[model samples]
Target chain A: MQPQRIAVVGAGAVGSYFGMRLAEAGHDVRFLMRRDYDAVKSGGLHLSSHLGDLSLEAATVERTPEALAAHGPVDWVLVGLKATAIPDIPKLVGPLLSEGTRVLAIMNGLSVDEEIAAELPAGTSLFGGLGFIGVIRGEPGQILHQEFGAINLGHHGDDPHELQRGVDLFAGSKVEIRPEASLLKARWEKLCWNIPFNGLCVIAGGVPVDQVIEDPPLYDAAHELIKEIVAAGNADLEAHGQSARIDGPRIAHLFLTQTLGMGAYRPSTVIDYNNGRPLELDAIFRQPVQRASQLGIGVPMMSMVASLVGKLGERVE
Target chain B: MQPQRIAVVGAGAVGSYFGMRLAEAGHDVRFLMRRDYDAVKSGGLHLSSHLGDLSLEAATVERTPEALAAHGPVDWVLVGLKATAIPDIPKLVGPLLSEGTRVLAIMNGLSVDEEIAAELPAGTSLFGGLGFIGVIRGEPGQILHQEFGAINLGHHGDDPHELQRGVDLFAGSKVEIRPEASLLKARWEKLCWNIPFNGLCVIAGGVPVDQVIEDPPLYDAAHELIKEIVAAGNADLEAHGQSARIDGPRIAHLFLTQTLGMGAYRPSTVIDYNNGRPLELDAIFRQPVQRASQLGIGVPMMSMVASLVGKLGERVE
Candidate 1:
């Protein structure tokens, strides 16, 4: 596999963790950041993780897209921003993409690929990447990885070469990357866990994942929400002549057991909400629920949580 | 109408406010208090209302049910405690009842009449009263009436005289009392507002009713919840051979407009959850959703809110 030049936009926890992994894999990884640019530039980037503590002593950091673009078009532009930062994507990443540059989004929620696809130059190959990791930004230029470090990557069309390219990008890294056949199905499958856990965490006043799992009623609520997401996902798949990949009971059990082992880890949504920052409500909640509604599928639980989280996001703003 | 003796068994806001009104109406109103005993005994009960300001100087206050029972079989026992205080009802208010005594529960939630009925002496006449008033106990003995002073009273059995007797007690008071033929139906009707406004207020992290109404998504969420409550209410009513009284859109409109005028009133459930007091979860949320589930009616919104609020209550404790 050939090493690629990668530019990471919105280098927060997700961005820094993955970019650091790519840099460790011997790729020339550049990070375009806003808040933590100075810290990352001076101190480099550090990841204290269960796998191993690693640091990039002198990482390439840029404060703006103009500075990142000055280095010429990169092979892979990894968009790792929160969904709330979607509006800033066109301005931030448009100039950093070349004709052959493929963009991979390590973010949450459904239709994220399409949303970013619309913002980028036409014919730019897009890959959807779902990060199932429990990592947090502890301090400036530092990350604390609690548990899980796996990414599911899938391309726009049925091209195994394109999918393998995304997988091969993390070849010698600590993070696991698995190529998926259907990006849409993978996103909806991810939503099976994200919709309930993240939304419930915020709606329940920023309660941690373990607290939600330990409480029987909240657990039952989470189970019901997971089932609703699965139902909506399967319905959407069937409508598109695709077989269902999400099993409600199976995924719910997996999430509960996994989250129980996660201790008191707070989800990113809860952290953003607690800090009075804008929630990724549109990408994580509203888009999927609205799409389900448009398909004439009922998602009462998701609808309720979406409206609530949306209002909560507005309140914080 | 003959003047009768009335004993208020829970001297919180609901207890004190109505107890003060009955005392002003020249009825022999006695309060069986716990936390506010000394405050009421020394300071008396003061009510500042839009209609008029009133106070009771040297009012009858009892520290125990035995003390209240010593007054000899009160004509009416008003069980005005929070539903969390229900388990103590058999011990606290059981001694205060006599053969001819009628119990009127001015409380929130459904099946409350049945809960109190099981605890009280058999063959005692029972009535359910839903308070639409916006009154809060500011201090120990002082109550602030915000707006809307109306109570819907309904008897257990179909008897006009029993309903009229319940109405006649508040004849000289400043509240509007309407008698309904069915207590069960009335409880469900109040839940159309309670399940949404009260439940959403807590679920949205203690957002005030005015804020909930002002925000579009929250209001939409509240509207959807109201519709679910109405659907569940009508289904329950139809199964019981009763017609529906809750009009979803109409009640939603009324609540929104009325709440717009309510300024920043916090619902009682929000208050209870905020103060770390035990929420009236079983009566207000769990029972209704369970009943709806048992009847094969879907109440996804209520189930989610109830579970979230229930967990929230547990966390606070």
Candidate 2:
């Protein structure tokens, strides 16, 4: 496959790490840095992964999307910003997009691609990616990748050719890319883990995921949250005229078992909360909660969890 | 009303404060001190109340119920220990009770009188009191009473004369006594306030009642907890062949409104949780949750709150 030119937006842990991975795979990848802009600009971006370390030169780092756009139309625009930053999608991506540039929103929450798609020109190839990874932003210019860098890639548009390209972009990288048939389905599946762990870690007093697992009521809420997400997801899939239904019990059991092995690892939201940064509540909790409610699913714990997490944020705002 | 001889079992904030009030009213109030046994026995028991300050002599403080019982059978035994201490009632009160001695359980949580009465000799006069006040243990020998000091007295058995005698005991004190006609109904009413405030305070990260109110999701859980308690209480009343029902909507509104006025007051459970003392989970949360579940009501939030609060306790235990 030809090395494609790619631009990375919201280059936090997810974006920077993946972008650096694809860069090592020989893609022409450049990052849009904000908080780490100065550090990365001077020292370049670094990804410390157990899989292998990768480094990008200072020339590959840009402070603004307009500066990143100077290279002209790229083959793909990879969005790794928080769902909370979705509103900035248009202005941020507009200067970086070409008529043929495919946008991949590798975000945690639901409907991110749709939101990004709405911001772009019509017929702009778009897709979604859900990274199941344990990674966090270290100091400026570095991302510490602990484990699992697999992304479930699914196209939002009807272009099968572009979806394959989304997978092929990570071909030689350590990150495994599983191209999914349905973006909505994959997003909901990710939410089965995200909503509970992310929201609960913050709600359970900034504890790690394993602390939540050890705590029975929190564990119960986590199980219920997963079950509700699966139910809501399956209902959503059926509503979207899709045939496959995500299994609720299996997902609950699986997530609970998986969470027990998290071994006191804190989720991203808790990290964000501890650092006093804005959470990705809208995409992660609010959107999914709204969809579940609309589907007539009973989501009392999930709703309460969302509201409580939102309260934690609304205090400052 | 003539001065009555009374023994105060559990000289924490509620017990010591109210006991001191009754002592000032000329009642011969003797107290059983545990944690503060040495300090109180040496320096005497003190109540610093906004209403008025009262202090008891060293002679009035006893280290054990046996020592308290040594003064012959008291006319009244005020069981002010937490519901978590219910199991000890038999051993503690057994030495304090005489045939004519009536037990007034001024404790929080459900079915205290029943639990006490069951452990006592058959036909032991047992009644319950619910104190609506703001009080806390300040030091070894002192209790800080910040606000209201009122007791809602009700007989667990069918004894009108004993109930009035219970009321008359607090006749000259600052503590206003409102003798409720039904213990069950009064317990349920108190629960409308207790279930939400106490449980939520602990579950909301050991914050005050006011903080729980300000937090939307915690507040939502609080409101839902109150609603579930009201429904459960009403159901329990009906199941027990009582004609009257505790109004759910009214209780919810009244408690939520009243809670907002609490002004950062931390409930007892939160205090216990912070102090590493046992919470009154079995009586306050577990019993009510079980009863509610048995009544075919959906108490998801209430149930979860109970489990979470319980988890907060179970960690150390």
Candidate 3:
């Protein structure tokens, strides 16, 4: 297979980690950073991961998409920006995409691809990916990989070959990549964990996963939240002519067991909230809740959590 | 009517304000304080209210219920301790109660009467009072009445005369005293406001009432929470062979409008949680939530809020 030229837009934690992985896999990877442009450009990118530590001494870096695209039309523009950054995507990444360039969003939350799709030029191929990794940007040019790292990838359109191509990008990497036929299903499945853990952690005032799980009532509430999200997600899937992909009890048990082994992890949203950064409320919370509402599903827990985190985000902003 | 003897146990804010009111009404009101005993004993009790300012020069104060009881069996023991202090009530106020001495709990939350009932002697007529007042202890011996000052009093057993006697204590005072047939109904109604504002305020990191209301989403969540609490309350009332008295929309509108006029008020639970004091979780949050669960009423919003606030309270304690 020919090595693909990839532009990593918004190279923060998720972007830099995956971009480095792709770079290590011998792909021509370039990073587009905003605030940490100077630091990343000077020092390159570093990843301290459970799998293994990685350092890139001389990697392609850019301050903007225009700068990234100035060289040539890249094969793929891998977006790693927080979902809160969705509004700026069309204008920022419009200049970066050619007709055949596929934009893969390695971001968390539902309806993210749709939001990005609304802004992109018509016929711009989009692939949605949910990164189930506990990765954080410790500092400029530094990424801390806490625990589980996996990517569930699926093309927005029904193109098996296209999905396979996206999957092949991470063929030999240690990071697990699962290709799915339905991106929406994948998104909903991921929300089974995100909605409860991320939402509750922030709602509980930025406590760790262990603390939230250890408290009996809170743990019970977490399960209740997960159940509500699953119900809503299934309702949404049914609306979209798809079957339920998330099993509440099974998924909740899996999350609890897995999270227990992951140690005391502070979710991305919690970290974002505590650091006074913009939360990915629209993508991770509001969009999914709105979709669930449109489908006539009641997600009171999610709605409340969304309201709380959204308000907290506003206060900080 | 003869002036009755009253013991104001746990005279923090609600106790001091009402105790002073009864005293001003020419009743023999004695205060039993814990933390502010020295200051209050030295400076007496000061109440700054919308209706009028009150300064007591020679207030009868005691540090313990035994000391207060040493004078005699008081006609009324107005218990104003935080709901978290319920465990100490049986031990603290046990000696203060006699056959005819009625205990009026001016504290907040549900099943408070039951908790107190468990610890008190059999047939010790209990009157539960919900203080709808926005009074706070600004400092030792100082009570700042922010806005509305009303108390809804109801008897635990079938005794209208018992309830009226409790109401008659504040007959001529500025504090509006309302007599209800059912204390449980009143408790649940008060929770409609408490669960949303107090729970969310603390959950949102000690945000004020106005801030919670000003944010559109938070305001909506507050309304949703009130609706759930009303549903649960009605369910609880129905379980007790009573009909629903609390209208979700009407009561919610009343609370929102009244809160708007009250400016920014930091609720007692929020203050307690922020100041590292015990939250009235069992009575305020857990009891009602448990009642809802028992009746198979799905109060997802309340459950989540309860869990969040309950966890925060635990962390602080």
TM-score per model (chain B) = 0.96, 0.95, 0.96
- Residue B316 miss distance in model 2 (angstroms): 5.3
TM-score of 1: 0.78
Q: After superposition, how far is residue B317 of candidate 2 from its true place, in Å?
A: 4.5
Candidate 1: residue pairs that collide: none
lDDT of 2 by residue, B1-317 (tens): 88889898977788888888888888888888889989877788777878977777654777788888887779888888888778898888889888788888888777777888888889878889999998988878878887677898898874788888887888778889988877887898898788878876766567678777876656777777777788888888888887767777887888788788879798888888888888888888888888887888777667777766766677535
Q: Higher-TM-score candidate among 1 and 2? A: 1
Give the DockQ (2 decimals) of all models.
Answer: 0.36, 0.23, 0.37
TM-score, per-candidate, Cα-based: 0.78, 0.74, 0.81
> Model 2, stretches more than 4 Å misplaced?
A4-105, A110-128, A134-150, A154-164, A171-193, A205-266, A270-283, A286-303, A310-317, B34-50, B53-59, B66-73, B118-122, B214-220, B241-244
- Per residue, candidate 3 scores C-alpha lDDT tens digits across B78-137 of 899888788898878888887788888888878788888898889888888899988888
**What is the C-alpha lDDT profile of model 3 across A1-317, one tens digit per residue?**
57889999888888888989988888899888877788878897888997899989778888877888887888999998778889989767888888799899988889888888998888988998888888888888888988878998988874788999888888887769899888888898888788778888888878789877876666777787788888888888778887536677888898877877766899988888888888888878888888888888877767877877776777778
User: Considering summed lDDT, which 10 consecutive residues are worst modelled in model 1 chain A?
Assistant: A240-249
lDDT of 2: 0.82
lDDT of 1 at A201: 86
For residue A255, give model 3's deviation from the true position in Å: 6.0
Fnat values, candidates in order = 0.51, 0.21, 0.49
Candidate 1 vs candidate 2: which has greater DockQ? 1
Residue B260 CA error for candidate 3 (Å)? Answer: 7.4
